[model samples]
Target: MTVEEIHGVRVLTVPEAGPAIRGGADALDLVAASFEQQAEFVVVPVGRLDPEFFTLSNGLAGEFLQKLVNYRLRVAIVGDISAHVAASNALRDFVRESNRRGQNWFLATPAELSDRLAGEVEAGPEA
Candidate 1:
C-alpha cells in the first residue's frame, strides 16, 4: 500500500499485488488502512476485488460501500470495469450514479481521480 496526496486529496492506494478482496471484512481492512494515514480516499485497483465485488445482486458492493460511507471515506475503484458493466444494467446504473454522487467513484485512472478532486474543490463545500 502507498499513501500520497494528489491535488490535496489524501489517497491511500492499495498495492496492485495485494491479496484479492473477497468480502466486507476484507473491504473493512482496506478502509481501516486509511485511518493510520488519515487518508480521506482509498484507491483500489479492480484486480484486487473479487469477481463478486462487481455483482450488485450479490450485495457485496453494497455492504462494502455502505461501510465506507458510514466512515465518510471516499474511494475510487481504478481500472477497466467495462466487462462487468456490460454484464449487468444494475451495475452500470450503480456505477453511473456513484460517479455522479462523488462519494464513491468508478474511475479509469488515478489521473481521473486527481481531476475529480480538483473539480470538487472548485465546486466548493456544496460538492
Candidate 2:
C-alpha cells in the first residue's frame, strides 16, 4: 500500500499483489486503509478489481463506489476498461459520467491521470 501525491491529492494506490477486492465490504476496508495512511484518494488498478465490479447488472460497482464516495474519498480506477466498455453501452456511459463528475475518475494510465488533473486540482480540501 503506497500513497503518492498527485495534483495536490494524496492517492492511495492499492498494490496489485493483494487479494482481489471482491465486494463492498472489501471496498470499505480500503477506505479504512486510506484513512490510516492519511490519503484522500484511493487509486485502484484494474487487476485489483474483481470481474463483478465491471458487471453493472450485479450493482457491485454502484454499491462499492458509492460507499467510498459517501466517505468523502476521491477514487481513481486506473487501467484500460475499453474491453468492458465495449461489451456494455451502460458501462461506457457510466465511465463517461464518472469522469465528468470529478469526484471520481476512470483514467487509462498514471501519466494520463497526472496530465488530466494538472493545475485542475481543487483549490482546497474543504477540510
Local distance difference test, each candidate = 0.89, 0.86
In candidate 2, stretches whose alpha carbon ends up further than 4 angstroms from where it belongs are 122-127
Q: How close is candidate 2 to the true structure, as a TM-score?
A: 0.91
State the local distance difference test value for candidate 1.
0.89
Total backbone collisions for each predicted model: 0, 0
Question: Compared with the true structure, what per-residue lDDT tens digits does model 2 show for residues 1-127?
Answer: 9988887778898987878887789888989999999998888898888987899999989988998998999888999999999999999999999998777899999887887667475434441
lDDT of 2: 0.86
Q: Model 1, stretches more than 4 Å misplaced?
A: none
TM-score of 1: 0.95
TM-score of each: 0.95, 0.91
Best candidate, TM-score-wise? 1
Per-residue alpha-carbon lDDT of model 1 for 27-96, expressed as tens digits? 6897789998999998889999999899888898888888888889998999999999999999999999
